[model samples]
Target: MLSFTRGSFSDRLFFHHHSHLRALLQYRSTQRSLSVVGLLPLSIVMSGTRSINDMLMQAARSKKGAVAAGRPPASHIAVEKGKTEKKKEQKVSAPHEKMKESGERESGRKDKSPSTLEKSAVAKINEPCEKDNGTAVQNGIEAPMEIDSTREDKENGTIEEQKDSDMGLEEAKLPDSPDIPKISEKISLPPVGVSEVPSITECVSNLTKRQLEFDPKAAAFWKKGEHVPFAFLAHAFDMISCESGRIAMTDILTNVFRTIIFTTPEDLLPTVYLTANKVAPPHHGVELGIGDATIIKTIGETFGKSDAQVKSQLKALGDLGLVAKACRVNQRLMRKPLALTCAKVLKTFKEIAKETGKNSQENRRNKIKSLLVAAMDCEPLFIVRLAQGNLRIGLAEQTVLVALAHAAVLTEKPPVAAAQLPGRLEQAAQIIKQVYSNLPDFDQIVPALLRVGIQDLSEVCHFTPGVPVGPMLAKATKSISDILDKFQDIEFTCEYKYDGERAQVHYMDNGSVEIYSRNAECTTGKFPDVAGAMTRYKKDDVKSFVLDCEIVAYDREADHILPFQILSTRARKGVTLSSIKVQVCVFAFDLLYLNGKELLQEPLRVRREYLYQSFVEVPKEFSFAKAITSTDLEEIQAFLQDAVNHSCEGLIIKTLDKEATYEPAKRSNNWLKLKKDYMDSVGDSFDLVPIGAFHGRGKRTGVYGAFLLACYDEDTEEYQSICKIGTGFSEAVLEERSASLRANVIPTPKVQGRKCCGCFVSFLFL
Candidate 1:
């Protein structure tokens, strides 16, 4: 037997060869009984197998048994050997102090004679031991050896080897082998007190409970300023889309707005516009102009697919948004894209809108592709839909306003109980809706709301001269009797409802005239003649005014008002005074603003008086709507007939006195439209075919809600889209019709002579 003390050269050599000795033992034990392998002991195995042939024989025999005995397998042994060689090379190449420190750390345990240590280790290995739980225990060490053995068993082979090794080690009663010193214990101090870091749940809870504090000076989430990720808005849209209840959608939007108000107040305007599926105010006339083909092409390019493949996927998915989401699954990028911010997205959309003239389509495609490439998660779903000019998430402009109102109130830190919160929210929502009705410009309203709070929002934003107010609507009346019965004893005026487009003409203080449609779309370019005619008709004293009127196609020589179909024939854009083929006459009715003063709060009678005094009639160029102030049924019926005779659609009976203030964006009960069509049965009917449908929302969810009806043109051999019908069907009828139409559904519209009308239909019939 060889004996040496710790730190001796021989002892160091023994320690270095320890892993090899174990490998030899593993081989011997597998080929024969443990008693036979233990006969030679660790010293003779280490000393005897010095030659190349002897070592090769030992390694070959040990290969199977080494793996079977829960030792490091051949591959693991090779890796370990490589690691050991690298460590040796580093130690040899290192500075003298580093080598010395490593040597001390490896051998720093209390010194013991090599013979004594060998005896102790041999005694521990030879003794039979009970299992500690399911693990084999050969020494004091528990976890590391057991874990390595279990891992090797899984990696190298099956559990049979592990079971045999565990049982063999437990049953074997071998003679003493040389001892191996235990690995040094790494001293890990217990963490000082509880961890200082808060959990994700705790952080979220804190944010929810924390009162909102608006700090204009505080650093924003984005580099430029306070801006939210576009993903945040997409997630909200996703949640709102999945939800069918209007109240639930409102709640989700409310929370989304709250987060934006707290973290990035500057992004609130863009967020609001995106939520409403708009890039700018309606009167701005900004449109994305991205077609389905362009969107499909952009998606295909981003995901490395053909347009046909994208179209195929779109057919399967019905929605381009879904197609985008599905295609993104396998998408790879050259580098990680910059995170999209709300302001960045709005800016991109505005850029897309500005793209026009030669190569405009290609430019738009590239911009859209960039957006798709940067989009992550459900963001692609919304980006596609937003480009299509519809979100289809059941989030109405009214609902967004309601949510915005509530979010603003909550951010103000209302000093009220939970019971009072709902009332406060409702009051704030009403105020916002009212202000938005009068102003209808988020660019003006949102900043004002955040500045003066919801209480004074109206004072800050109301009836601006350049911005068009939402036109007040009227409820349809069945007959003159219904109007008479509803307005019993209330002073009213009956005016001719001309068969023409509703126009709101704004004469600016700079002597510039602008015209807006009922939906607030700019039509100044479409009707240059009408704008010129308005200037000629206006009195010299009328400096700046907003006139609510009807622009009708009129015959100058015959002195007759043409039908609405004739007015629709005029060019919608780029029309010059010289190219005025379809001449229009403006019949001014009510004055909303005059000489920089808002008359919205004034009675209809007073506003009407202002309208008549401000502008004079110019025959076919401009005039006032013929009106009669009477309570008699016979007189009203005669006037309605006269209106019909003059190519008017019906009569607009409006309250002239009490409760008659102009209510923009409202379908007021104070005004009623007695159309000639409502007084009789179906006078005209067309055999229209259902070619396409719009997906249902709200109560009509999960079924077709509206349909695109088209009439066949025999001469063109095509189906010409006539109109879209949504109101006549009941719930049961819609489902029944949807079932029948669903079977005929095609992936895309293939009808000939169907012009690009910018209508997004959910499903198309063959």
Candidate 2:
């Protein structure tokens, strides 16, 4: 049988000693006010009464010394083995039921005339009077209604529903307090304060009222302690059925946090809706706010600890974790900075039932011993989490946001929607927070977040597909130096290039998949891991997701990717999982089409921001390709060397500027690459871009090795080869070159025939 119990250490202790009268007697309040004491159950008093009742009934049925009684004592029913009521003891105890409800005892506090001896003398008169029987029956059902719920009442939720108007109170599921010993020592508990009910009602009533008095411009409802800063967020696209986007809800809009700032609640529906579709990738890592680092440092200083110590403390609260060391190398998982989590604030007097112990395991069986509610959301994925980066199927921050929105259970969607909702983020969030607090199920959250705003709740499909993602690279590279040198001033960045195949991974609405290589070839079978990763990480019922990544080969450990040749291992049919271990590393460079929103025209900076913001971190085996400043030949060289050292051939540098479009099948200059082997050896730089090729001859007959190479004749409208160099050759290269020639082969391909590529076309000494 499954058992559900929860509570904190203090709560458990309280539950264990709940029934002790001696403990209650230590509290003057319970002793002075019987009315209050009677409301709560005291098992000991009742247990004594049951025993007395049984003995009394047995004695009444006994005949006092008839003929049979004289024959033997065997028929005499003794209450105990060697005990009996004393013949001289005529005193009876006061009926506990009457003593419990009679508030006349409180009258003594008002008028203290009776002495202790008088009270003792009067105690006998109050004992078992014939009138006690009538009062006992009436008080048994009415006065002792202190216990919250009967077993049956709790099971059907009749008591909960009736108590709070079906507000989900039954879900609390707290454990039962244990029986207390009558003679145990007292325990002290912190004072409990009653919330100001009227004030709470006031805040809840005027929640959505526009033009609130405090500060119309500032979105806050000046509450005690601190003001809540709220912003309303909305979603921005349509999606397909298989995707997280709720196509029907794409149009939904909401302002969640706006109201929450001024003491208003969040607008959970729209935010949840926007998140459902993954408008952004699902990473939760974020750049620290201005001065936040200093603040952390200051706090650490005040605590007389190093930044690391402060950070560790924060991690204990689930606020911080390790980070990556460098872009080129494997992630270092450092904890340089600290942040916070929802669990941090909730540590105050709040704990789950599963966290406590005290009650017997058997007694605690399936007892919904205790429950606590809190609003929680995921942070963006950092470089530390290898797989859950901006790649094939890792979750990003936006996914978490969506999940949170859905958790709120507002009008089916998060506050974010297709329509802009920057003005409403704060308010939308509060509402969602309430929803999340009440119900924390993933299914509930996903559907709500995916629901397109302003849609008929009856719509079968919520998410849409074909959302274009990426135009997000920078422009204006006067020199590689311009990118490398000026990045910091504008917070710009550059990334490394990979020599593997680039894939435009499409997640179809029908739950199908298609992976298109840069050359527009369908290479889906060549990389099954890509599809499998997506299927697993993506939320259930998500129909589609289109991603951009580099597919490279791998050894047994998926951490390192092999060269292009290794990709051949998976190029053929009937490749068993173990037979061919050259797995592929789909290096996710960016997020293109997530859910239904298209980010095509957005700048590279914007795209990267979205990518980083959306994804939640997962560990290595998959990851986002690291990036840096585009220029600084020195840095680029270092990066290129790093890439090469890691078995990569080159580095592709991307500008953070967003003017460039990611033209699939088109090699635009915006994304230029520098290979480790491309440096000039003797003199002049080669102008070959692998333009066209010719049929092979001689030893290269079956293969296309001695094929024509091209140099750009800028003056002409065509490309002509200055050389046809073919020196670096291997059997495998010969075969691959032969196969690749069919597409690039030109009918009238021409070559200089005299000298080959990389050879000095000596204009110097000629």
Candidate 3:
């Protein structure tokens, strides 16, 4: 490797800012009207100037002309330029170095030697300078005057000064900012420690060399098919990583090649994590119609330059919707990002290969491959990662276990973690991991999770009763501390939070647990456990009854909450006990039907009195989530704390007056979520680590645009991009991060990725 440390090239036809113009001239000279050389037309070159610079320039011009004609450059052009640039670095210095020869020649001239004139001509270099006399002179710049009494010395000095000065004018120029600063100057990047890499060049270079070496003949197929999508994804990846365009492109080829091949070539459908950028209500009407170009312009101005050239690039990004279309985009929203992992990517590709027959090129050619709409088939490994958002050999499973720990208040008992419940999605992933460690990739994981909880049964429900829940859960709270002190005598009631469908489980004693979802639609077959559990309930007054409770995953052996995952066990029917070990536990928390009345108008206190006075209480398997009511603020605070510790979403404070009527199916003001976490934090607080980021969209693109944060992998060192977070940032965060993150630009590209030993993200397809 030729490393450039310190040196100077001799007199050579180095390219100036006028290089393209010079090349244009060379192109014009070529009778071909297309050759590009240093200011000479191909006609001139063909007639022929045999200099190497002229030849290279001519070739460059020819290539440029071809591109203008809308043709791709032949591979030969890149190879040719590579060689030319290498050679130019080694060019000889100006002939002015022979100043000593100049004097010798002059003496020879005095001696009337024949070689005198030729030698003097060779020593003469092209240079001119005015001698403080303020006049343009054709002779070289004069050296500082030195008075020499010695006659021979004075004569030799004069000749040498003239020549050497001329040579000084021809030395090669130096590069800009040679000693590249570390990305994180404040924190040194140790060999293995997460270091700030100011730029992505070195890694990108290695990637480029690898690509050049990747199956040369398949170049046509891959090149024509890959470039644009690869380019865009790489660009997005770079923005997220804070790397430059070239570096992003380089990383794409190196790290992300396999994922790209397996994903949609045009839209890159595999990467589902990059939500289309849009202005959120983070700050309502902060500004309008502002674009990244504006931010770039401002940055340019700050740098004492203009963004005229960069505006178009920013425009291209906007057109692609990689940035918001709004005029004044909120800096916080624009900076929120999503990140993916390498392992997920590998699993996605492997699944695609398997589904399409790994080596069956002929089959793939025959198939009109469209796009990957759904994630790759769920692999065991994939499931483990999908839940944890990270995939190390043992890492993903650890996440679910932690979620279990949180739900069980394991963190509070000994570790005192802020969060507990492994939420629904995390609960599912944890289940998969708990059951299997060497989980399959995403392609294998997604489907199984979908089968259990995903209900496309839109045929039954209308509105999305519960929020989309986003990609992951924020936090759930039921704290009633604030409202408890207002009431003199709070009522404490325990009703079974039934596990079966809550949508008015209407059974006319017809030997059926005809249940609907939270939304009313008779889904009788979905939960056989709920049906079986209800049959065992000692309800002599339940000839025909309706109740409300959650459908839970139960383990008959433990008769306890199965880490919120026991729900998955009862998904499909006709199962032998050993097959899935599916069981059900019913927690009937309320009742809307008894005898022959619809109690929708009944007050919570009345219903509680009826439930407590009417039903029996059992522990573990079938009972309430457990609750206590109080008028004291301390008691309410205790409830909130205990609920949070119990993996519950804070506390649910409810009015208990007998006159307080039930507001069926409404998130009314009568009940409020006094969440412990939300009371102190903004938006929802998630323990996510930054995995990817983006340049700020419109307006705020100057500083760090946005960031991609993911849940941490306790076992595997990875972050799976789940949802693109775009809210709840304080100004101080942006101000501090703006300076710090510039150092840690991902050396690997996000679009594709460089080779990674662990799991990569496959969420681009989610």
Candidate 4:
């Protein structure tokens, strides 16, 4: 037997102790003329009587509420015990019917004075009256009523009996206070010097007007402190779905953030994360682990659609989210749905994450099905997209964060003027971006900004020992000449760009090391040997530090570094020192932190000096990236070739200026990736703007077989035909490109007579 009991009423309704009594007492206190102590018993009795009558009315209306009286509880043990136990008591009294009979009590007191009648009414409060046989009377009115269990009403247990079991309870209705004057009650305005008090009608009219002013969709969930429907977010997602311009996308994102700010300010973080198309912060690793199979199964279970039917919809729509939306709109529901809240959705995702081991797959399938069933139209669409991690809504995390900063300022009390807003908004965005670059968690940042302004958030955000910070990015340049042009007169240090994985290694004070990828994912388990190497070669003076470096596979016997492919062989999990084949060397370059101090704000030159002085590099296990400091192009050219000879990619030309501070998660000209691929004369590699492509057949079917390259026509601000190259690309590259084109390419007019080697060339705009 399944227990469907949803806990107790006190757990579901009242959040605090004696809440009903407190509410009643508080209401009576507002009227001063009423005796709160005397009204306590009267209030409870009235509340109980009203509840019994309401349940009886509901039972009379629907047979769904009916439950067998002699069913003998659910389980075998309870059945045996129930046969020996005493029969439960039952009594019924209708307050309205009892009030009509009050004339008898009043007639009996007709000869008595008004004070005597009042006393008589108070005296009969606890005594049982003879009327209706078992009905108890309180103050000439019906007291607490136990529901009758007579044969006619025996088909079902009363409301109180169902409270201990499965039947859903209706909301407890409180009786209206008799003290507050009704709209029909006479009232007179006070004389001179008295303040005006609103009448009951005026108060009710104002409340209705306020409700009318609120957004209907938001107001539905606002009273319960739940998230607005996903339909609202889907509308925003639709607005920016096809938009290409940055400004236009930013405008739409800002509008969405403003809506969240105004409607559910506390939900801002979860909303931001969902809109960013992630379940949690990048560093935290909260994957939904929901595969396409899981999504299909959930949709099938939810709508009773077969796998083939779902597949047909998916193939036609080309998006799982759209498939879900279509299925949801087309299918009829089995039962009333539970409302989908942003918080509820997030919590469900967390629950899914916790389902593990043997039965985990079935557990996940059921949970996801519940979520899909509870969600409607656009809600299931977003939920499916979120699970798939393919929210194709053009806005990125940066855009969302910028909009959040703007929201914080715009939604502040005593609104900021329009003219003064731009500058403050920019400052707020920069502050938020800076904090996010270090922390990168909206769960932490959003609440801090909401609690204390941006100023405090900036000060509060810091680099923790284990959590990964976004790696600093470098701008790309074609030549040393172009790089010099950007950093004119400033001497720059050119470091060899090793063809290896970029790793950020944190050496903690507790003698533990954690390594993270450039994307801030913890890859600590994948590089246990690297951790051992760091411990062996770590500087004694450096109690704790963060090293930004490259980890390349080392050919120990040959005394040379292997390519990235060799290092890629390392396992992502369950790595052991004994089974390790490919040995790696850490090429330390920039020191972002040293000895409990963050050097991100310090000059690159200063950080490099600390890096060189603090740690001694081991030969094949660890070493600093070879560097040459010079402003001369010829010297840099020679160094770049030497790097290429050593299986390196190219040179990373970094500014040697005092203000060349490390900017995380940013691409700045201060640090440039001077790669051979960008060189125009190299011929081996050419960066051509792709403006069109020709569809393939036979071996290259269903994809754009070859791309039509172009050069910028500055005067016309358009692309001109250059050359098409299709031979070099692999099947994987062609398929990836084809998928990208199919998703992002806009339709354009065909070239009537033009062909690239007997193939039709289809042009794209962006």
Candidate 5:
């Protein structure tokens, strides 16, 4: 009798079926052969059967014990391990499995199918491991089996979806393991078929094509005291340029500012100036001094292109920044360059500005090339535009101030609540705007804001005696009647609107004087004679003061003021008191600061009194503006006539008391100018020709918005730029003019005697 104790069904079946054959062969063979063949088969079967039976019995006992204890048997554990291995394998191959399957199908292998074993394996792989409990015997151990439906799905080529699902599950569980590195931190591996590493240029091109995404966790990744990469600002500029709405631009800038504030507080000042397209405060007279020629040449040398090629690209693209970006995509650097930082760019700009004297152009080119070589993605675009001193993005100065204010408030310690943030931002923005108007210097305001907070920013950054303040502006009225109507029942004063450069004269207690233009540029070097004359005319008691005056070209012997065109002829730099050819008179109007005290908050009447008491006037050299305090329409008209006869533009009417505080950088209703051009009659007309046209924006799109007019100088046989005319044109007229000038537009301004206007008037007609 054969005892089938402790054997799996398959093992017992194999032994029983072969037992019959072994017995027959043993009976048919001779005694010797029977002993060798029949005994060999019998012995082998018995021995294997004995060992498998023992192992099966042991496994059966364990399964019984585990069932009683609510635990899986050993085979179920193996199945779990197999599933895990399969999942990992699937992850490694999931990216290419579909391609392999499709390739196999295309090669006339549609009839090919997976073996039964492979189908079973795939079925086991698809089953959910967490719900697996049923066990079936395999060899001698009990293993879990999968449903038939999964096997059928695999046969139908639906296993790709299962592979994807498994991969997603693995990724989901990754965060639970702290030792596992993140996907981004993992080293990138080459694709399956790729044999060679990508070139640097190819890598950069791929990176450039990828859209830039702003990461909210940027601040967390940056180490403390690390200089902010210039790429951050460049990215912000790219976003700002694409957005036409003010609010959207402000949001982008605010995020950038907030990041800079959190990561590198010291870089905030330079970053702000760069965003404003300035290298330093206007009073410092620091400029990039980089011209288009230098930029074109630098790009050519750096990228192995000719100047003509660069210019052709520039003309086609209409932006040198874009041209640089296009050229940079194909250029390869000798070695990996160090990443550019905000502070580094600003310092390089100052260095470029200092590149003067012999071989200065070459030095500037070298410095610019270093930056371009290090630039990646949109960096070259912004760097070129920065060197050009015009970002061309529609970012306004006030928008920058708003962004800065919001950033400071948001990044303040003991962070603000979400509900109160908008209100706080608005309040802080107003405070910043107020303080900046009083002192329009980021060098002073940004540091103060960061140190003392926006609450005390005004106290820390008030109007200093030496620092230039943005001059107050006036709104133009159509006629004297309009000015009288606006200032009805309000005491007002009329002063001659002198046709000269608006100069802010500052006299320091150290016996040194400085002159600044209305835009806050230091003109001390350009008007040394005016600086000397301020000392000669100041009162003995006045030690330091900031006087808002106009510097007009004057004829001292004839005691007459010359036209403003004559004033513009003087040398702009490297001027000495003795080298002055065009003499100018300082017509002081409003006193802004006196002896270290700010007079901006005082009424115009009080400021005028201070002005008159603080300075002594000399004829044709230094004097107060010709003024008359009156509201009579006839008297104002007569005064206007007198101003016109004196070569003044018109009359400026200012309020005496109510709402008359000096509002810096504002075209306020408190002051109005009655210009001769605003009158009904054509007071003056120029016989000039249009040399070039500027591209329009906003509603003036697709047409020339303005024309550069030049007057012929008979003595020099040259075309002198007189003015830019953008007004008094209807849509029909603009389109007509644009059509007429389109044919005459030349690739370059090749006229021999044309003066450079330093503007974006590229479509030259002459």
Candidate 6:
């Protein structure tokens, strides 16, 4: 098993930005297109700057190419006019007159005139400067041994003997500032051809070997080790947007898992939770409590849309997330959005869940709006969906587990093949599913799996005292014969199924007790007596264990169990011993966990043996259910009859096969329920007042035969009309009652208010 610390990967990747880029490149090359990766650069700021530099370098290359291809040199061209141009021109031309005269004298020839073309060319070459304090010019070929003082030279210093110099060469270097290359041209990317693309597996392998992180500005891009842009999940959503089949979803989810496994495995848990549209497991009790009204208000407030506008969109689109998406798309005033990450999304959800006090709704609304503000385009659509818990991608927890299992298998030393992947995946998924059934929290499961592996994770999966495990359920059967046929050649046990609330009672080593209902909701206070009764039986073998039983209302004086109605009178919470009215008994039928070890895999026979030996039984207070094991149909029928006679609902037939084990969140055939509802019984009656009559069809078409009835509520001081009395009355009874009801039928305007206020019809027979 591999042992590791949290944030180790993040620390390694965060500080080294280049390795992050290398990972990103490998990821893009191997899995998605570069265009998809374009928006999510490893370093957003640096990528932008690199693009600008590339453009500038390309322009410099083009300019150098133009020069080598015989284009005019930039520096030698005519210069643009500047602030000092006139003064510079006057200073330069002053030296030309002397140089021309000196050239004529030196050549020993009278220079009567120069060609117009030659003069203009000379003027252009000598336009900017004269060397050595204006002693040189464009026209001068050479000069030696001169002593003179021009207006400009005299102001500077005394004239002395000077040497000949080239004026045209000096003019070439006169321009003080260099010209910049034009950057107006467009740049294009190379085309992606078929030969350039890589396989998904290859891409995954390459990504696994590299590290990745986002730019600093994208620091908001990660939350608790999860990266941003949200595009990764969005892309996966796009792939399965229209897919419906389980196989197709599994394929898509498997790929998504592969993507996360290779790129950002830290996000796996949050992504799974989000995909499941849950903040945490049911047992963990984390709830967002965000409602439609809150989401609507947030959309209107954050996106600048009016309630009417949002309502109109909702009327057209039906989904609030879609409405939010539309509003954001059409918003005139949009804020620059920070990249959204799985971690950030989960963090926001956690904060929203943790908010309490009087202003919690307001605080929650603000947090939700803030998240919406940071979302862009399709991101808002998904963000709203996640907030609303309406991800509705047709993915369930089971499918996600399967996907995670596939990812785990692929991450193995010798990767499982695609053909053999499904079988291995199923095996991995069952282990996770079983563990989750007991632990029931992805927050605990996913991290453990990441640190160790599936095998080690299965070992850690055990029933804890405080945490509730989903109780195993049974399939319903109609008769004793049906139950016998199902377990024909097997040894099965039949126990009375009591008429009471199913509770999972956990006794912790600290001497604390908790009782949870079948739905895994805490009902500890409601069953205070049950907890107190179990404390007496806390032996060495049963100090800390989970017991599955039926908590029934008990009549202490009569020494018998009461109906479910008596138990229903108990308060839900804050049940005080002094205030107790409905005394109850816990009929424990099965033991799942004992002394901190889960016996869920033990056969029913073994579990029952342990359950019987663990604790002392007290009649009608805390005792195991009466059981009789047999294959005889007649004996089972007698036991079923005895259960009904003793006020039990019916019988619970449990399979005693060696392979029979407790499977949570599933209704297996190994356990069967036969309730009294399937048996014959005398019907119960209710106190109902006759209201109006309905004419029967066909046989008594014209006559008012059936009567409408209502039940009286003592507390509300109002009568609630319910059910129609159409079947019980005979012709003789109806005939004797017809006249009395007619005379007593009150007129609509004359009816007076009392216990019953509507128009009344009283039957004399009653």
Candidates in order, TM-scores: namely 0.67, 0.31, 0.29, 0.64, 0.65, 0.62
lDDT of 2 by residue, 1-766 (tens): 0011211110001111111212222222322321212212121122232333333233234442011121111111111011111233122244645433332333324344432111111000011112222111121221100112112231322111112111110111112222221111112221223221222223323323322222222322233222231111210111111134322122121122223322322323223322332222211111112122332353343334566765555444322212111111221111112222212212211221123456423222211111001110112211111111111122233334433333233333343453444334344444443333222332344354345322322233222233222222222233445444544444344555665777767787777776655434455666766666766545554455566777767664556667786675564443445565666666677765556665544566766666565554344446678766644567766776787788764566554564453443234556655554555332223536555444456877766555455664432324555556567887688788667655544222133333546542321100
Positional deviation of 316 in candidate 2, in angstroms? Answer: 83
Q: Candidate 4: misplaced stretches above 4 Å?
A: 1-221, 224-235, 238-265, 680-766
lDDT of 1 by residue, 182-293 (tens): 1111112113222234322332232222223323123122333446888767766776777767777777677777777777788899999999889999888898888787
Better of 4 and 6 by TM-score: 4
Report the lDDT tens digits of candidate 3 across residue range 625-703: 4656556666667666766654455555556663355544344555555565677775344656665555556555555
TM-score of 4: 0.64
Give the runs in model 6 whose Cα sits over 4 Å from its true position. Answer: 1-229, 306-309, 417-422, 557-560, 565-579, 679-766
Q: Can you rank all candidates by lDDT, best first?
A: 5, 1, 4, 6, 2, 3
Ranked by lDDT, the better of candidates 2 and 3 is 2
Give the local distance difference test score of model 3.
0.35
Q: Positional deviation of 378 in candidate 4, in angstroms?
A: 1.5
Which segments of model 3 are wrong by more than 4 Å?
Answer: 1-481, 485-504, 519-526, 553-559, 569-582, 617-619, 639-650, 674-763
For candidate 6, lDDT tens digit of each residue in 227-334? 634655654564555676667666666666656655577888888887777887765556788877788888899878787777778767867888887877765331
**lDDT score, candidate 4:** 0.63
- Say which prediction, candidate 3 or candidate 6, comes out ahead on lDDT: 6
Best by lDDT: 5
- C-alpha RMSD values across all candidates: 16.4, 27.7, 25.5, 15.9, 19.4, 21.8
**lDDT (10s digit) by residue, model 5, range 532-638:** 77777888888899889999999998989999989998988889877778998889899998888889999999999999888888887888999999877888888
User: Model 4 over residues 1-766: C-alpha lDDT tens digits?
Assistant: 1111122111111101111222222322442322233221111122222242342343234332222122221211100000011223223244534532432333343343222112111101112333432223332442222222112121232111111222212122223433322111211212222223432222222212221132323312233355755655655666566677656666656655655666677877777877888778877767778888778877887788898888777756766788888887876432335567676777778788778899998898888777788777567777887877767665677778887786677666787777887888899888888888887887788888888876578877776666678787777777878877877878789999998999999889898998989988888888988887786777677788899999999999999989897898789867999989998888999998888888888999899999999889889888988999888889989998999899998888888764589888887868888777778554234447877777888899888888888786533334567787789888998998888777546444333446654555675635
lDDT of each: 0.68, 0.36, 0.35, 0.63, 0.69, 0.61
